[model samples]
Target: MSEEQLNFDFFAELSEPVPEPAPVKENVDGADEISVEPAALSEAAAKAESSPETERGVTPFVLRQAVLGYLAGQQPTAVGIRVPTRVKKFQVSMAACWIAPQSKQNHIEKVVAIDIFDRREHCLPDCAEREELLATLKTLKLEKLKLEKVIRENEPELKDSDDLFEEFQSYDYSASRNTAYHKLLKQISRLQHVIYKGSRMELIRQAAVADYLYLAVPAGELAPEELADGWGLLHVFPDRQVKVVKVASRQQCNEEGRRHLALNIAATSLKSVLFANGVAVDEHLRVSFQPPPRRRRKRL
Candidate 1:
């Protein structure tokens, strides 16, 4: 009650420091301890929302590229070119990256995410072409199957005693029929090319040099110098051909960088095939690059 005591107590209260808040534990592991470091929770949430699942066959990297490109009003082309490695270039599901039309629903199936390289756009050979090709193949396949069946049915008799074997051989129609059918099927198979317009990019064959440039070949046949990173190149050793292809980026390459690279490529070929649907870059293909035009000085 003393005036001195009241004055001292009031001053003590004024000088007392505020108690600190309890530390927050983010996880059971001490390593995950929460810090007071300032960060926007909404920013972290946005990142989580943006994170993509690569396991479900969706290339998160590619999808991101496509989304960004779309937002910028630039269309990115999909490349199905293959690489020899099994490395996961993008966080995506194998099915999404490998299968198409079926995995179209996958978010990664967009411009950058989709494999447009090995895509066979195959026009199903125009109705006329389809009808012609299918008819020949069906006919040849049917005859081959029939001949094979006939040979199997008469196998016992054909394998009879040695003396009868000679007589059986004399009357053998199976061998001749089989030969005919084989030849026919082979001919039909060649016609199968007529059935393939090539993948969608192929349909854009007109785009070759005109709009874009693409080559469909077994990854193996491709020269080492021609190979690009990130792509899984499947080569058939015997034929020296590339059987399957997909687009890939190098470890250091990011989606935006790749988009620029692709755009540059498209621009380079734009002058050549700008008017045609197809352009062939065969062994005889020759290209000579001219220096870019110089900028003139501005008048003062």
Candidate 2:
């Protein structure tokens, strides 16, 4: 071939890219080949797509678990592992009981209770409101009787007067009483809520009086003043590290109350609360507290 022709052939070969292999097609009686595009996802991509990411949080449940683990990992009488505990009070939810000196199993050395924020409204009226309501009812009763007397004396037969008399005679204070009762209940609920939110120290004080060493977390602002007397604060960190802000040692604990907590903890399984964070406890504890494997419901 001439030099120019040889150069032309080389340039053509370089300019035309090498063709890639087409997807293999079925060879059936010279049938028309149908194209099928390959998936873009690689092996890793497929695996990743198959499983979605799980949600994470440092919620109170999580913090409590961390505290449980931290405490459980301790040595004797040294804030050791959390024993099964229960809430004796209807209002309090989280609680724990630890035996003292690691010797006596029956005696409860410490009772730790966490007071979380409760937004549930109360339903009851204040004393002043109740007194005012009573006075108002008394006034309405007198006015109703006086109006009835005037109507009876006048013997008015007008439609409006008749309605007024009938209403007075058939006046069912039950409805009014019911309305007032509900309002009072709402007031009470509000009072309870306010007592819990603004002045939760009252509840904490009650616990202290009961001789329970109470510990609250995220350390509320008022906790310093209200709970400062006897209550302790637990400061939990993101890295699952629990720092005890204020250590409260109960000098005199309600033995019965502490026992009730222990019994309640003993009654409920750990999986319900502690393992709620997706972390499992030790094998022995798991066996003891772990819920029976939830039977998977068959899909219809």
Candidate 3:
């Protein structure tokens, strides 16, 4: 083919350039940003979408199983473990060290879940350690028996025994009038620990009958409605002097709330409070009570 004929063919081929398709538009407002496509969800995603798995719905049996399974892989003295699944969204669920009062089992495992489910809300478990409904009622009845025993022991003061109520205001009066009995209840409460079920939130307060107590709490999300007297529960319990209470209440608080309430009860009742921060007990668990340093008088 002649050079002129080849040049003409090349020019003819170059004349029909391919046209590029227009870029896809995401927002109708003429923004260059494209729409974010949702990721394809897996089975885990499907379960999450179907229903919220929080501490509330989690059973003690399931929690015990999970803790045992988890601990089997770790040290027996391990304090806590983070659960990746079976927790409410935007929450951290943990199983921590606890002791059962009924059995005096050391390092008893308990579950705790926390998030800001309700900003204004606070929760407290009634008592700790797993006791049957009848057992607890019977225990309360025993409190009555103890009170009667105290009255009988001090026979001369039976008429004024009712006045003992005035002196035991600081005690947890859920059962009896004796200061010793209230102290026993506090001990029982201290031994009691909280468990985070599958969907519930837990809270702890600085005071049992706090009008507006400082709280360390956990839940799914802290919403504004949960606040009680301008107190929003937050999760920042220290890892020492901590106890859990499995209190029997009309309603159950989530694990986090129960933890906070238990810690507060421990702090006020026992002169010290510790939190289970997923760390095993060590030298750090010991909290010493030191007197304030005396100031030296200025030399005249």
Best candidate (score: lDDT): 2
Tens-digit per-residue lDDT, 229-277, candidate 3: 2232332111111111111122233455445433433333222123322
Q: Give the runs in model 3 whose Cα sits over 4 Å from its true position.
A: 1-92, 98-172, 175-199, 202-300
Each prediction's whole-model lDDT (CA): 0.30, 0.38, 0.30
Clashes of 2: 19
Q: Could you give candidate 1's per-residue lDDT for residues 180-263 as a string of tens digits?
A: 545644554444333333422222221221211223222233321122212222222222212223223223333343344344
Off by over 4 Å in 2: 1-57, 75-91, 100-105, 116-201, 204-212, 219-223, 226-228, 249-251, 270-300
The per-prediction tally of clashing pairs is: 37, 19, 49
True lDDT of residue 140, candidate 2: 34
Sorting all predicted structures by lDDT, with the top scorer first, yields 2, 1, 3
TM-score each candidate.
0.21, 0.36, 0.19
Tens-place lDDT digits, model 2, residues 80-168: 12322322223333455556555554466655554332111111112223333333333333333344444444444322323344432
CA lDDT, candidate 2, residue 101: 50
